[model samples]
Target: LAEHVVADSVLVPGVALVGGGPGDPDLITVRGRRLLAAADVVIADRLGPRDLLAELPPHVEVIDAAKIPYGRFMAQEAINQALIDHARAGKAVVRLKGGDPFVFGRGMEEAEALAAAGIPCTVVPGISSSISVPGAAGIPVTHRGVAHEFTVVSGHVAPDDPRSLVDWSALATLRGTLVLLMAVEKIGAIAAALIAHGRPADTPVAIVQEGTTAAQRRVDATLDTVGEVAKAEGVRPPAVIVIGAVVAVGPDQQP
Candidate 1:
């Protein structure tokens, strides 16, 4: 039955959740590139390698999956429905996302939805921005004898938010590296929380904006000063915040 299903799937339409890597179009895996080139329709998020979309054939259809229409963002249910609808109509659908599809990109949710609807789905992994973004700024997430372990967390919610799963106090005591995503808007509160919990105010921090792209820029500061430094520099979203001794290992670090 399994072999028959696999063989039968070849002739049926399916969904491919392809990770576009960290902003750079060339960084995408060969398999991902081939799949993108063959896709009949693509549903793309704002953060992926958008340049690749322009390279698609004129017959391919593209949809902005993340666009906010009429002051409201497109719901996840709607996105899933669009994918199922397109695939059922015999079109090869590619749901392209930035970075790794599983790393906070909610690719699993879409996969589950497709499964429930009896649609075949495949996942292609991409390099997560959690690691590549820091590397783009010359900051290694883990260095030899410097940082042995690294933790990646989403800073979209304030430390004090009731829905937050992270323990700010516990994170403060950890000696390893901490990489934060979507935290630019709440850096002040997050920085204050770390300091209040016991992380030294002098801990080195690096913020890499638009990492891995030509527009990439790096800003260095201490834990206590990162908030103000980022604000003064006009650092925006789609940036990565790296905090630890590893930040000092970068070539751009100051004495």
Candidate 2:
């Protein structure tokens, strides 16, 4: 296959954006694992199934391309340049990210950069935490006769931020589920916005931290108190915040 593929010029040096899947190493797709195993170099983010990195062969060069939204990390330009540089050198480069690369993972930006630089790129979709995390906690993002739709948004910035694009008022009017990733830091403000925008103060909320891993823990509260409860419980980043009645439909719910 290797020689036959080379004869047709089908196999070329390029970058693969592989989604590691919500934190669980086993959740990664088969294709993603295969590409990861064959990669010559891997640029990984802080999230995702990081434990899998330890399993890589000694010859596989690993680069820490972690970019924490509000924290110190590598610049996006540098990460793109790294992929271009490595692939141009005839190496199989893998850009491993947590969850689906296009789901707020900045995979598109990297792909565009690679394309502009004349490098080939492939994307491997992974399970996003927006749904998986809630599911891991036994809470379905969408439940029949409960919630028929769900919306996932980034809470990296407060709703009041000038650069923020989310319309908190519209979100408040949504009768479906609202899943907020990276909102631990701004949960207080987000919850306040939702409540102020018309969401009931008593709307059910669930905050799942380090979801899908052994360290997972959940804190339940209402929209009025979720932020304070999350802070008091020491919920940190990398957690998923679920709002709406669907949160009350988890397997552990009481009658």
Candidate 3:
């Protein structure tokens, strides 16, 4: 079930940024899996399909990148340096991330670091949780007549935070699906922002926790009530929060 990703085309002493897809181990792309199998050293993030690590050969070195949500984590610089050090030693290093590496995964930063260190880097795309998670919950991000566009945003920062780049006011005006990742802690503020920005308070919202995994569960609410609903339901991290009419298009209808 494995083969060398580069074979003769790319050389060793390099890094492969492989997206491990959403939490399900089987969701990873073949290319990503192949790369992982070929790696001599794997630096993994906490959010990906970590169970796959057990499949690696005993000789492989596995380093925990420890990107736990708002918790103790290996600093980005440390992770970058670790990749560089291993690759510099002529080892095939794989940086396995959850969802698409470029989707709020901080993959570009790592790639840039490798480039500056004169290390070769290859990217393997993975399924992003933004779409797959919602889909797993029976929610289509876009529907024929319900929605035509969908916006994916990071909710790590609250709408009122000075560091936040999302234009909540603008987002509220768009009549499309809104997908929020890393936003569980701030769902109340997010929902409030949208409502304050003129979005209808009654817009349907769905919070799918642990999406795509066996532990997956969903809670429903209107935009005005999502914050409270999420709290009452104990919605936690690694969850996908979807907002808009598309939430109503799924098999389950709000009561």
lDDT of 1 by residue, 1-255 (tens): 011112223432488899999999988887678778778889999999999999999999999986523244258888888888888888888899999999999999999999999988888899999999999889999999999999999999999999999999999999999999999999999999999999999999999999999999999999999999999999998999999999998555656
Q: If scored against the real structure, what TM-score would every candidate get?
A: 0.92, 0.93, 0.93
**lDDT comparing candidate 3 with the true structure:** 0.89
What clash pairs does model 2 have? none
Residue-pair clashes per candidate? 0, 0, 0
lDDT of 3 by residue, 97-155 (tens): 99999999999999999999988788889999999999999999999999999999999
Q: In model 3, what lDDT does residue 16 have?
A: 88
TM-score of 3: 0.93
Q: How large is the C-alpha RMSD of every model relative to the true structure?
A: 3.6, 3.7, 3.5
lDDT winner between candidates 2 and 3? 3
Clashing pairs in 1: none
lDDT of each: 0.89, 0.88, 0.89
